[model samples]
Target: MPPLNYGTFFANFNLEMIRPFFKERIAFRRKAPRRMPSLAFTTLPSLLLLGSFTFFLAPPARARLTFHPTIYEEKADYLDTQTVAVYHFRNEGDKTVTIRKVRASCGCTVPQLDKRVYLPGETGVLRAFFAFGSRSGKQEKKIRIWTNEKDLKKPYELILRTEIPRAVRFSPIFLHWGRGDTPITRTVNAWVEADSPVKILSIDEPAPDFSVRLQVLKPGRGYLILVTPRDTAKPKMRRIDIQTDFPRKKPLSYSIYCSIR
Candidate 1:
């Protein structure tokens, strides 16, 4: 016998089952006063065969790697000089995948992975270490990842978001005096922005031409620094350091600028 054509067989089978309905429809139309169109009924068999052939020849599904959460958020305390962010993911496709590279947005963030290759249905974790150093306020880091999967045109990006607390927030960190100007005392306001209590340990002595003093406004919650120039006849510049008891290893320090022209 000749080779069997599945598409033709299916089309012929369906047409046999639907032939009774088609005959009834035609008989009813013939008895009616007006004649209905027959183009759709005539072309339906060809369309059905084409659809069946296309469906049988379709391509297989591609592999896909998915993450539980693409974005992560956290709140960092003042004592935490460094923080780690974790991203959990798994291969959900039939093919195995290999992570070619992981790139971080900045040098302050380092990405780490246990291995490069992962089999189908395997799980993995991507960790990023962010060094706060002297950074404060809201911070965000982006990580781009590459894989051996071909279906994906662009690399996947993961976001790391954090809010770092400030030990003390200072306003007007700099004070200046113009030449021949009157020597007046200026005040710098300091507000405790950390969750824990932070006290002003001491204020270092400024240059001989400038004097500095610290006063408590709300105990550990707030304070004020008073700076004055003994004489503004000569130009002078100085940086006054304010010590705090945040942490020994990563102590928090505040500084203010003073200058006379």
Candidate 2:
């Protein structure tokens, strides 16, 4: 920046190595000391370097694979377990293309490709596996695909959308034990298949006339409840509110009715 001193910059080079251009630049600057020095000498050296970096910045190349459901968005009434959503894609290009790798947004989601390479017009399936262990509500996931497409440095993002419902199904919400019949324990099973493992947090407090116990077939997902009337002698009504860990608006509760007839 301080006027490039040839003696300091080109000190290592021998005097005989000096080009005619450097001599011409020195003579021209000497003659016009009052005028601004031309930076043309520096521009010429830059041109020589530009030859090494002459890659033309161009548009992004075309993709070889075309997906059937380009964007996967589906609503599930209930996603009880880890689910895999598959996307069908074909090599639309005339040439073969290799899939280098497939990645997902999170560890909970994984992308699976059958093979590395695919021939032209060959169909391939991309399976996106989503694990919803204890999560509920609307879930959105993304999968990034890397391929051998020319000039394609950035990966393609595939979007996935799912809606998980608050899933707790009770076979019979209402139970009755007749007065004349011998009192026997009645069972109600609460089956839950959900991203969030559901377990009964607690049952509503003290119903003196009723006896209730819970049985867990599968830790969080499946539950069996035993409800018995203390004595089926008189008419008695007990309100059994079942609470679960499943995500819900408030209280996170399911209701069951118990009555003595």
Candidate 3:
């Protein structure tokens, strides 16, 4: 201060000017620590919102289904005078379903399905009855089922076939004939209602013990045939041939086979 040094004076003045800047920097550094907790709290809410949004956006799981007897009635066969039953079809789908109808390719096969609606994981039954009474050898039949399922577009089919023996079958076909041992005497007794006029042209017997007689109750209207067997006649099989004079149905034949002791 006594020598009045100008360079030293200017340096001292610059140091005083920079000292306020240092103080301000230190104050800002001290305030940074207080801001850390507020910054942390603000970021936590944003992170929680992001996590909730991600969870809700995920896709849902898919439903599943199962079917019982997906392929059924693999094989079915029968013989003459044999009654065949087809195994029932069962469903195990995840959703409810209904069976609309059941049908057969031929009159020989009769099919019946459960008419009630089936619920999820429920089962239904289908029965097929085959009558081989008059059916002869080498026959093939089909049973079709219609259902209300989203997956199935057309009716499902079950196939049945058989190699039948060459034998004659009677119209009064059953386990036990409704009538007793007494033979049918009148043609009217053996007649059945028919849409077209049926006439018996001729009768034949394969075995000596078996015999047949015919009469026309009404011309071009109806007729009756009498089937008789001798007391000592032990016939293994019997057959009868009927000829109709009508051209619509040229000829119709009826036959029967039975075991006599």
Considering every candidate listed, which one attains the maximal TM-score?
Answer: 1
Going through the candidates in the order shown, the clash numbers are 0, 3, 3
Query: What digit string (tens of lDDT, one per residue) describes model 2 on residues 73-115?
Result: 7666542556678899999889999998888888999888888
Candidate 1's C-alpha runs over 4 A off are 1-63, 173-187, 195-197, 206-210, 228-239, 246-251, 256-261
Better of 2 and 3 by lDDT: 2
Instruction: Quote each prediction's TM-score.
Output: 0.63, 0.43, 0.37
What lDDT tens digits, residue by residue, belong to model 3 across residues 70-167?
33332323222554555554555577667777788888778775565777766556666777765555667777777777567567777666665432
RMSD values for the candidates in order, in angstroms, are: 15.8, 18.0, 17.8
Lowest lDDT 10-residue stretch of candidate 3: 169-178
lDDT of every model, 2 decimals:
0.88, 0.80, 0.55
What is the Å distance of residue 16 in model 3 from its true position? 50
Error of 3 at 95 (Å): 1.0
Range of the 10 consecutive residues with the lowest summed lDDT in candidate 2: 51-60
Q: How many backbone clashes can be found in candidate 2? A: 3
Stretches > 4 Å off in candidate 3: 1-82, 167-261
